[model samples]
Target: MIPSVILLEKGASTIHADVGEILFHEDSMALFYYQVLNGRVRLSNFLSDGREVLHNVICANEGFGEVAILDNGLNTVTAIADSSCTLLKISSKKFFEIMHEYGHLHHVISQKIARELHFKLFMIKLIYNRSPEEILSNLIHKLNESKRLVCQECNRLMLTRQQLANMTGLRVETIIRTMKQMEKDDKLNIVRGKVFVPADGID
Candidate 1:
């Protein structure tokens, strides 16, 4: 079974947030991490140029604040709700207690850290080196590998060009032009909102 923050014996610390509400400020010290029971959480990087670079989205049944919880440092990124949100919070003290009591919790925490490290490397590549197609492909593979995403329900599915671009941090226009070129070369088959690897093959 997937472990959830709602099940944690962390005390009475539930909170509600409206859309666009900041749950945790960037670089702020964390007293507790939260388990999202409902709604969406966006983890974003605010640039000096005033651009909001979206990093990742955390939906219901997810936990946040692990970075500070593990290292006793300020929040690395800001967390805000994208919609009405219900969160179950656990104090840092209680979090450590649970970790001490549960070996699996320790494993989960370690994996979270490792995954974030891998993600950061890809983000660096996306910003510095790779093309949109390469970046988008890496992004999808990263999502698929993350413990947070489950994909068993659907098979042989595909993504739209714009949809792929969002994850790659590239402009929609660039993605369109790149895809058009790929389509011409028969590197991909674009049909009815799905971009397939071949003209006819199983996903």
Candidate 2:
């Protein structure tokens, strides 16, 4: 994320968005830079077969739409609110101005952009080459790193089967079957509709 000056610039402002609202559309010009103040946002796109693919699930204190703005091009994916969200919306002009004024902030932002791209590419390769259980485990482990989907033990993951399916590109039924098998094998547990994977079992 960028500095406070970038967030508090002349044209910058905050907005509250409801869940399921479309913040922006894919292929549209990137007019603003958005940083999530709270709640979750999803950047996604549809595949050729009409299936939805989640490119990223962004949480609090994270920024999106920067790549498009930096390139002065269209958005590569649509951003939608996954929960009621508070966001800092800054005009691209002010955003660029502040970034240019702050060299260190620019370096941090560049590093974050590279990290995000690396994670996305890693997930893409995993989806094609790994087993469903392995895929689910890895996704859970990654989310836990941010503590966005963790529980008291830090070993428990609070996710529904459908959510897991959407993230892993598996059918809901497939996720359920695989999870049940994993449960029987003591690899994980499904209690009260939440998926739980022990920290050491996430290989």
Candidate 3:
């Protein structure tokens, strides 16, 4: 990920967003490269049926909206703040200029795009004919492996049941029920409504 200092040096500006604030809309022009300085951001879209499809959760120190900028196309997903967030943003033109000046940035961005594509492909394969428990387990495992868990120490899952449902294409009720069963099976622990995976991961 690009450092804050570099972004600032290149004229990136700081922006604060409250929870539920929309950073950008799907199908809108991509004009800036944004990096989360604090808190979480959700990248998602709505289906024809009005159901939400979660794309990715942008956490601190991570960047989003680059793919649209790189392709010079509209954003594929809408970005909203999941919590009060501080972000650094640079104009797309300036971002491109910086990329050109820093040849290694191309490699970094390529790896990021490739990793995201791999996850999407994996999820597509996983959701086909997979049980809710299987789907949730694998998704959490993958996120953990990627160091995307909100709390690394206790392995607490930061995503809400609704968010989990959005990601897995399952109903929120199904997520709640399956997660409770998972806790019963000792695959995870639900402490005060929060989910915590064991250090060694699900059984």
Candidate 4:
């Protein structure tokens, strides 16, 4: 949905961030509400002692930093560029101005909230599961069913290696090794930037 330019008084700005670049730090003054124009954004958390832990990855066409615009005057998590990326941003003040002008914007926000809650539930299930592969399988199915380009064989997203790590809650090194083994065994073609799930055989 194109945000009505009339209601939002923000001056449009674009930003490009390199791999692993910190876009915004936690507790930073809420200035801009961003949309991923290219690449991905990783929302991460830090422990009291400053350990960087990945919370989740925001993919293409997603919106972030809306919560602060809705309630708090500050942000909750640090957003970092998952890789070299581009973002289109609108200032927080302008973000809320449009929110107030168009009540329907809340509906869009609700949808995002729903997806986040669903992801959280899936994570909880993974935490309690006895088998990590089973957990990964379940996540693969969830994302595949949600309507992105899924490899027909493994049902994994046609995303980059790092993306697989973010989606399946595994390390990139581990996923790469596993993918290679799967490919060697004729499971499916696992390219670095895509997972080609074949039409059949992995029943």
Q: Model 4 TM-score? A: 0.74
Error of 1 at 175 (Å): 4.3
Each prediction's whole-model lDDT (CA) = 0.67, 0.81, 0.92, 0.69
The TM-score, computed over Cα atoms with residue i paired to residue i, of candidate 1 is: 0.72
Flag clash pairs in model 4.
153-197, 153-198
Best by lDDT: 3
Task: Please give, for residues 1-203, the per-residue lDDT of candidate 3 as tens digits.
Answer: 99788899999999999999999999999999999999999999999999999989999999999999999999999999999999999999999988989899899999999999999999999889459999999988998888885478878998999999999899899999999999889999999999998889875
For residues 105-166, what per-residue lDDT tens digits would candidate 4 score against the true structure? 77888788777778878777774666544554565555566644464556656556665565
Best by TM-score: 3
Tens-digit lDDT string for candidate 2 (57-155): 777888998999999999999899999999989989988887887778788889988888787886887799558878876777777665665665756
TM-scores, all models, native as reference? 0.72, 0.88, 0.97, 0.74
lDDT of 1 by residue, 1-203 (tens): 12554245446377899998998888888887777888878777777976566666777877778778789888878888877999887788887777777778778878867877788777777666457656544555455455333233442223434435544667879887876776677655567655554423222
Error of 2 at 46 (Å): 2.1
Q: What is the C-alpha RMSD of each candidate to the true structure, in Å?
A: 4.4, 2.2, 1.0, 3.9
Cα lDDT over the full model 1: 0.67
The clash number for model 2 is 0
